[model samples]
Target: MLSIQNLHKTYGAQVLFDGASLQMTPGERLGLVGRNGHGKSTLFRLVLGEEDADSGIISLPRNYRIGHLAQHLHFTQPTVLEEACLGLPEGEEWDHYKAERILFGLGFVEEDMAKAPSTFSGGFQIRLNLAKVLVSNPNLLLLDEPTNYLDILSIRWITKFLRAWKNELIIISHDWEFMDSVTTHTAAIHRHKIIKLSGGTEKLYAQIAQDEEIHEKTRVNEEKKRKQVEVFISRFRAKASKASSVQSRVKQLEKMGEKEKLSRIANLDFAFHYAPIPAKRLMEVHNLSFHFDPHKPLIHNFNFTIHAGDRIAVIGKNGYGKSTLLNLMAGELNPLHGTVRSHPDLELGYFGQTNIDRLHKGQTVEQEIASANGALNRTAVRTLCGIMMFSGDNAEKKVGVLSGGERSRVLLGKILAAPANLLFLDEPTNHLDMQSIESLVEAIEDFEGAVVIVTHSEMILRAVATRLVLFQHGNAEVFNGGYDYFLEKVGWEEEGKQHR
Candidate 1:
């Protein structure tokens, strides 16, 4: 068992947690959730003794084995198989077999096992890191954003493995569906405190939404009463007969208007505005195939069409050419075999991982949006900025100081500000908060244009995708129905049913 009591932690003037406490028992899995800089990782550091809390006590049994997945991978071992086996006892056949099994489960083949960790892509490197951690067989695991670089298949495999493992875990993942799958408890950091609840993330978020609604209603009613009392006091205070009544009303007004700490939840407000131009056929791919090597192809004989109002989701395991397909259609990548044709009038708004880095650091949010399109007027630019959570003076802040989530919003704002009829978005919700994700879902639902998105986030796929493109071993198939139908067809009916 692990227990944190009367925790108080702060970084300079920023108070992250004050008097926060939590308890986790053996075999319990807890999901830790919060905004980007809200101390989720800090809490992990505190628990691991990498940092010290100003005032607190974290108690655990002696010799409690803990395994933490490192944020970055730097393996000195000669091969992937050797690195994964480093923690296992030497000369033990069972340990060697377990390590091999973990590596294979995470998509490492026999050939990959002999390759250096640097030979893998960033996503595969993350898998290697996870495999290294899992092979250690710790009693408690601290995984931060475990699903960040993983695709659907690897994510499902990891989820299944964690569900059946009898160990304590504290995970931080933005993917709500993944969190709901393995967590036995949910913990959220809000208003400088942690709220721990039994059950999964879905129920916890639902309760938070309901509580916010009730708080808003209560605040509105109090404001109305306070305004009425103030009005009565001002009108009747001058009259001699009503002086006493006015004094009483003044006291009532003071009581009603007394400052109370309102709920600090700030919701994201945004919308996508697209030109009402329609094209029957926006893009077409015919016999498309791409390969780095002449004899082997990552994508082979792929064919698909994009029309206005088509919301297609591209999903598969890591390095399986989901993003390659999007780039091919967007003309970022040239196909070796077939051709991709697009409408002459089609304007593309593409948002990928690198788009955030492409933003100008010297420019403000308003300047960034306005510079993206010369035709955008001051009001239009400000409107776009406001939608991206840069309100009033906030629109003038330099982009260089913005956080990852803030930069993502700015990049999205720039994309939406354009008059593109087709959007190619890769991992649109990667660093966004729940409120921002909700706004994005609404924006996509209301968009009149088409979208080709490559994302691992089940929430976005379920909310925005109307068509599905499932990628497998060097092949692709398009499902005519929605995300649920695709999930059912792909042997995820039970998982999909639980989330639904």
Candidate 2:
């Protein structure tokens, strides 16, 4: 029930949208795909009237109500329950159960319902806004990275929640599995155009590739014909008898249309530098116990072992000792009780959200990547920069001027350039798009060493996790099986009852 007609948007030297158009059928679920700065969110703002397009028609009915997860937070109510209930539509304010079901699914406890909204953390505050948007029941729901703040349990809850959605939805997410699971169609922003298709992302991407391939072949054939004409004209020009023929060829060459060669798109393509070792046992954890309070232990008397070629995923609800354990394993934090023993030749590379702050703001992207691995020479450094999609002069961009996504890429480039037998990553997909996350999946799959990550994406977990460090029921424990086995045998405990 929504349509964008011949959109043309630009900002100075950068062209965000050029004659881009998309149509959404009523009750359609669309998964929007594009690079980070390719105008996915800009299109959202254009539809919402927050930003004006240079020239376009974004047509929707007068009664259409749009719901989005607001970045700004201004809670009029003090209690969490009351603040959430504020999302109830007019003449239905008494239906607080709708809000409670959403709040509970979003990880709010019974006790938390009475707590002040201001007392919650920034991430949880964002979730509160999300709950409001979800409960509002708008005609068109636009969610951009709703899973960024969610834990594995909450993500599962939202997945189920959105699958039952009857209204229109346009979601932009790096978690392909989630988007593919819920969406009926896939749409992408490619070459300044919106390509919409039925079925999933794989099908849509294959169609795009086939179209581009045909375009390239046509361009090549036209170039060959033009070259042949030019060569015929040049070779026969000196002969008096061939003068008329050469003139005709010249006329033909002049009439031939010129086609611009398509530049190769930059994509994240690189493998992590693996440092192989003969030893099987990489690290051992003995009676690991850690806590911020003496009365409550988050990880208590936990024991686990890390081996070479291991893919261990630490998973649970947010604030439930996932990242804490990752930090402890990476040696960023010390355990309160127990020993985390490592092999003598253990080499580590870590990608964490907090690590972004450690980057030198004054240094360039190339400088930061090279600093991670001192043995890498200038050529290797530039190659790594190119692998990160920072080509030519963009490699010299100062870290201070980079966006959050760019900074995350620099952090990953550092990890890839270094020699690491063991990797510790926490929410590595937070600042990445679909393409970059797919590249990350390949890098993890191709790496010869071990990897341990904390992520909310079931897609990545199912792909890489051979072992799991599960935090559930107020205890952190290790599960010997993969994510599929865990989901089949031991699903998320304490999740709210399915409302659908």
Candidate 3:
């Protein structure tokens, strides 16, 4: 168990947390939720003692063990398994056995155990980091965005593992379903304060909103009563002895009257405008096959046709060719065996998770969007940037100085401004806030183009996708309905029945 008391942290003039306090019990699974840049990660750092808070007291039992899985890490070990097994507690053969079992559960095979983690892809490295944290077997586990780079299957694995975990856990993640599956408590940071609720994450959020609504109603009724009492006293004060009782009642009302402070809810609405309608056939792929190596095929004989105003989602485990499929669709890579055809007038916009690495270091936000599309005027560019939450001086900041979320927003802004009839988005919502994701879903729903999105977010998929393309076991299957229908037909419950 751990407790934080009167915690305060500030960066320059910006206050992150003020008097935030929370208590955790053994085996408690807490889901930490907040908007981006609201110091969720900073709270984790404070608990881990990685950074000194401005003022606070973090208390835990003496000799209590802690494990933290950060967003990024560097491994120097010669093999992935070696790196994952480092720093595990000794003196218990069962602990070693558990470590190996965890590594295997995380998708490391016997052959992969001998290969260096440095040679693995970014997604693989992320899984390796998770394995490292799980092997430590600490009493409390702190996971920050643990599923950001993982695919659906790996996320399911983590969800199941955490559901069965017996120790305390504090997780910060954007995956709502995963949090609901694993956590029984919710801790939210908003406006420099922490709000704790007992329940699953979704239930907690709903309860908070319901409580706020009830508070607002109570406040309204109290104000009305106070006004009525005041009016009665004012109208009757000089009338006579008959109104003397009313005056006394007014004094009693004043004594009991207090205004409730209501928290302000920020409103964010995003809209996209489309040009004149186009033909129904947005893109058509025929017998498309791609291979990074000549002998190993990544996507084999892939064929799909996307029509205008269709929202299609691609789902798969990591390293199962989701990004590669997007690349082929975007014309960034050539198909090895077949042809990808698009409408003559179709303009394409591509958004990849790693697109930030391609940004020019010296380019400002203004320059990047301008360079992406030549005809945008200054005012139009600024308007586009504003929709993505970059305003005024932020538009002048260099791309190199922006945070990960900022960079992602800028890239998405550029994509939005382009005259694209077909959009290919690969993990586009990874670094985005929930508000931003909702805005994006709204934008996609309103856009008059075909969208092929590769993401693991069930919320987004269910909201925007009309069709599901599930990739598993080295093949793709086209399912005719939305994410919910796909889940029902695939029998996902059967896959987790044994574990449950």
lDDT on C-alpha atoms for all candidate structures = 0.82, 0.90, 0.80
The top-ranked prediction according to lDDT is 2
Residue range 198-252, candidate 3, lDDT tens digits: 8866676777789778888998988888888777887778878747688687778
TM-score-wise, the better of 2 and 3 is: 2
For candidate 2, list the clashing residue pairs, or say none.
none
lDDT of 2 by residue, 205-287 (tens): 99999988888899899999998998898899999999999999988888887877877777888788988777899999899
- Segments of candidate 3 deviating more than 4 angstroms: 70-78, 93-97, 207-268, 370-376, 487-500
Clashing pairs in 1: none
Q: Which of the two, 1 or 3, has more lDDT?
A: 1
Model 2 bad stretches (over 4 Å):
232-256, 496-500
User: What RMSD does each model have against the real structure?
Assistant: 4.6, 2.2, 4.3
Q: Give the TM-score of candidate 1.
A: 0.86
lDDT of 1 by residue, 217-289 (tens): 8888887888888889888878999999999987777666543546555567766667666579989999999
For residue 362, give model 3's deviation from the true position in Å: 2.6
